[model samples]
Target: MNKTERLLAIVMELQRSKLQTADELAEVLGVSVRTIYRDMMALSEAGVPIIGETGLGYSLMEGYFLPPISFTVDEAVSLLLGTEFIEKRFDPTFRKSARSSRRKIEAILSRPIREETDRIQGSIRLLQKDEMVLMMREKVNLGIIREAMTEDKKLRFTYHKRVAEADGNRVTVRTVSPYGLAHDEQNGWLLLASCDLREDIRHFRVSRMSDLTVTEDTFQTPDNFDLQAYRPKDTRSTQVCAIFNPEIADKVEEANSYYMETAESKEDGYHVTFRVREPEELLSWILGWGADVVVTEPESFINRVREEIGKMKEHY
Candidate 1:
């Protein structure tokens, strides 16, 4: 960091914490002790109210604070766009706060910067399905899940599975400790929680949740659990290979099936490999392709496809 930036950061660090030792400051700021000493001298010479004890540490005097930091046009634009995204993607509770924050940020910008920020922000569009327009049940579940996570409480809900059993039963009740929430383009909102019934961490799509309620019971989150880095293990190991007609190869790739591991185009056709929990998971997808795709490996899977085709022929 530049000297000016480092000076500002030192002031910020002091304001954030109490009695920061030179060693602690050096380690946190990634500078040497000698550099920290020099910086301390520089800060004191600049008339900053920093009190340093020989044995203890350094601290800013009570009631001392830095003035409001100014933002560049680019910074203002970035923050305004972030607030816009939050306003669209979050529930009503946070959407209102985002609007307020956007106004406050715009209010502080200078006339030229504000005009430039508005021009830039107007040119950029963050297009996505608004979360507020989602199903009422899903929106309610999202709010309850957020509150449960904030209060460190448990949540009880009925979840509808994506896949149904032979008996057509797809509903199950679950009580989970809401750990965190995530969103993706495909899935609107996913709740990562520790499931009581499954006795493990599980992801529940908010859209599939029904009758969600927060419980009064509170619990502490485990230190080892990191929401940002969490990914569910893919246990699908069965490899199924296929070849699609070159005419529809691009279309096949566009499908972007979760289990598609590899796709290669050769002289004859487009070779594709899929690893799935079970071969049956790809049965419908394969049938949808009709004669455009052919299975090339796992003789049993080919036979299963033949059997399905025979049944389909009989129906015809």
Candidate 2:
């Protein structure tokens, strides 16, 4: 980091804690001990009110406060946009907090920065399309789920699945120990939890949940569970490859199908590979591109594509 940024970081670090040794500060800031000593000298010269004992760590003098920090246009806009997102996607409690936070941020900004941020935000839009109504409907459930997780309590809900069973039942009652919440641009909010029925970890879409309630039962979170590093394993094994016309290769890439594995450009076209649990999973997506794409792998999938095309021809 630049000297100016490092100085600001040092002030923030010291303000947050009671005592910080030069060695500890060096480790935290990823700088050499000598560099830290130099920074300390600079800070002292600048009259930062830092008190350093010979053996003890350095600390800010009690009751001393730093002035408001300056922010660039990009930094201000990023923080403001974050508050806007939380106000839109989160529950009422957090929505109120987000509004308050936005006002506080705006209150602290200089007039010129505030005007520029408003102009930039005016040109940008955050739209959730058809998911807005669903998210609003499930907003209450999000608060309940959060409370359950905070209190280490179990949760009960009726979940709707995307696919139905042989008996044509698409809904089931579930009790789960909530672990974390995840948001995907395409999938909306999902709850990662340990299901009592499945006896394993599962992801349940919040929008597809109903009659959600917190239970009296409680549980402890496993020590190894880390929400940031966790990724659900993909188990789909069936492989299929398709060649796409160069004219629409960029469009195919933009679609970003979950099963898409690889894309290679050849003389004929862009060859795309997909791994799916079933060929049917890829049928509609391949058909969406029409003449722009041609299936070339898995004779079985080729036959299925032909069958679908034949059925389409019958309509014409």
Clashes of each: 0, 0
- Tens-place lDDT digits, model 1, residues 87-146: 776777887789757755764565567678879888999877544556364556777888
Instruction: Kindly list the per-residue Cα lDDT of model 2 for residues 1-316, writing each as its tens digit.
Output: 8999788778777765668999988987789989989998999999999999989989988767553867788998999999998888888888888975775576455657768988999999998555567565557778999999999999999998765644677899999999999998878788999999889888888989999989999988899999999897676889999999988888888889988999988899999999987777788889988988889999999999999999999999
What TM value does model 1 have? 0.66
Looking at candidate 2, what is the lDDT of residue 298?
A: 97
The best candidate by TM-score is 2
lDDT of 2 at 60: 85
- The stretch of ten residues in a row with the least summed lDDT in candidate 1 is 130-139
Candidate 1 residues lying further than 4 Å off, grouped into runs, are: 1-69, 130-137, 165-168, 247-251, 279-292, 295-316
TM-score of 2: 0.70
Worst 10 residues of 2 by lDDT: 129-138
